[model samples]
Target: MSAGTQRMRAAVWYGAKDVRIAEMDIPAAGRGEVLIEVAFSGICGSDLHEYADGPHAIPVAEPHPASGARAPLVLGHEFCGTVVELGPSVTGLTRGDRVAVEPNYRCGRCPRCRAGEYNICRHFGFAGLMGNGGMAEYAAVPAYMAHRLPENVSLEQAALFEPASVALHALRRAGTTPGTVMVVGLGPVGLLTVRLAAEREVPRIVAVDVSPARLHRASALGATDLIDARLGEGVGERIRELTGGEGVDVAFEVVGSESTLRTCLDATRRGGRVVLVGLAQEMSLDSFALVNNEQSIIASVGYRDTYPELIRLVAERGLDLTPLVTSTIALDTLVPDGFEALLDGPGDQIKILVDLAARSDRLGSPEASAGTRRVRPQPGGGEPETSE
Candidate 1:
């Protein structure tokens, strides 16, 4: 069948709080691309940002330098699917291959791209935010971005590779080795960071969050210590108490807020490293404290070439990420049961997956809908904030 003649259901984003489930023509794979029959697509934290206060990364006025895509684009970056068609000149992959989409756009000719740092290329954007993506039944992506999955890795587990890669990259950037580490958030990325840290055999793993459920999950994932941020005691103070008033060797700030950033800085030793993994708005920093301590503040963004290591961790080393997925809803509930559920009740969710193949009735019943509940906001709450 001709690509133009086939239609698929996609979640199209027009603007903030404006996403529609429309039938869009299936996109054809261009040269060096592959058309994938999507199985599962994850609603990322970036999607939440776009849904609430948006156009942050979505191109609207002018075309993006890389993808040249504008508004009304398909919305989903974390997805896994089976290759259905291979475009001309595409190599190393055949039809029926199950793979995870990397979903990054980069200007290959740029210095950063040439230097193998394509994730930070001069003009870099995500496929879902800046262009059409896998929030649909079928998505055409660059063949190079599709990483083949092993026999042990299911498509559902593969949907989380993108965020897992982010966590892995942040750890790599921090030069995390055997030492005391503290994760300042219980979000997906934060929890993944703890899991990775535990796997790496870090001597101490301290997890901080406002939600008891997330805290307990972190402990199960290998956190040696847990701190409830909702308690009147300050996070930095609590961290110090745990570290014998010396502070952790490395602190990861995954909350992306001014207060959380400060807590990370305060919780790190004088010469320890503080890694910023979250996306934060413009906020003031204490230059005096930063310079006086002679500490280093490392910032980590989207990953680069991290899929192989993550796949090995999951496939070979038996790293299990399935526990992080708390709920799965159909595309029809992408808004109410997916996005709004996460926003209104951040503490109640970890990761919500969109089962593209499922019908609306999968979660349409009122009894099923009641599972989506909201939690009251607490000061220094341990909501599952995303660092995606």
Candidate 2:
């Protein structure tokens, strides 16, 4: 690592099943950009999909149809960091302030951004997905994307703002404000949705999951009712009975399975709103039945301008995600161990954080691991070193 050039390390996604930790020089914050020393980075479901499959968020091999980012991208978006450096001419920000990053780098000049709907920006891309992300020691992000973290929140907790915003956006899309709510899928986002929905003044949250362990977590988080999908074939029947046949007013689908999508739609009341926040291969629905029932189905995409509200709400007492946090590891464990844990046993696990400064015996110094170095085709002939 050069003294003048701080080479930061990050989990580089080369391709499907080919993720390696690579070192890149600490990037200079361009105009309107701020450099952050990442404190913690959380993993999301989409990240898992990218790990197991291809066509990752913010396309790499091909320019993202939307974000315009190409392959060999750094993989991380759910993270929180502190501003250590600011770009020239940037204002209203400073050093040493804790903050959460809203990863989507939308072309601010686009029609959607002009209309304040940047999530659907004609050109949208998230930090870790679209550009270099917080999986590294230092990340250069847009100044507008950073939100100040409250004093009471820990770095790990603030990292959740990304996923929490995803759920909040889903709820906001469903008009899920201050009322009865149903969250199907007990993963990180589902649990965060419950916690945030409570802060929104929703009196009851009924959670459904296939894992009993998740149901227990939901109960601890104030879920009034828990349904174990593994033991029952009639989940819709159970939900209807639990709600006294009125059915839930709003349902959030966080499980990325076709069946869960159908279940979410079925669990909502005739006139209720259902927010489809999950990403799955396919879902079959009868158009006539959906229209005739007057059911409002909303497909909430990535968060727009909602990180500040999430930070504020999370700092409040109503939504405390501290308990939902499951574990914390260093960045070196991200590709090898962290990804394994997330895939093998994410049941009941709400959030996992990668701490930047907390180096363990497990994570070696940046240059010590030859195992993480990459070998690539040299020019037009042999392979070459791709890392420090």
Separate clash counts for every candidate: 1, 2
Prediction RMSDs, each to the true structure: 8.1, 3.4
Show model 2 residue runs off by greater than 4 Å: 1-5, 64-69, 176-179, 316-318, 346-348, 364-388
TM-score against native, each model: 0.91, 0.90
Model 2: residue 176 alpha-carbon error in angstroms: 5.6
| lDDT per residue (tens digit) for residues 334-370 in model 1 | 8888888888884779999999988777344554333
Residue pair clashes in candidate 2: 60-70, 60-71
What do the candidate models score in CA lDDT, each in turn? 0.86, 0.76
Off by over 4 Å in 1: 1-5, 362-388
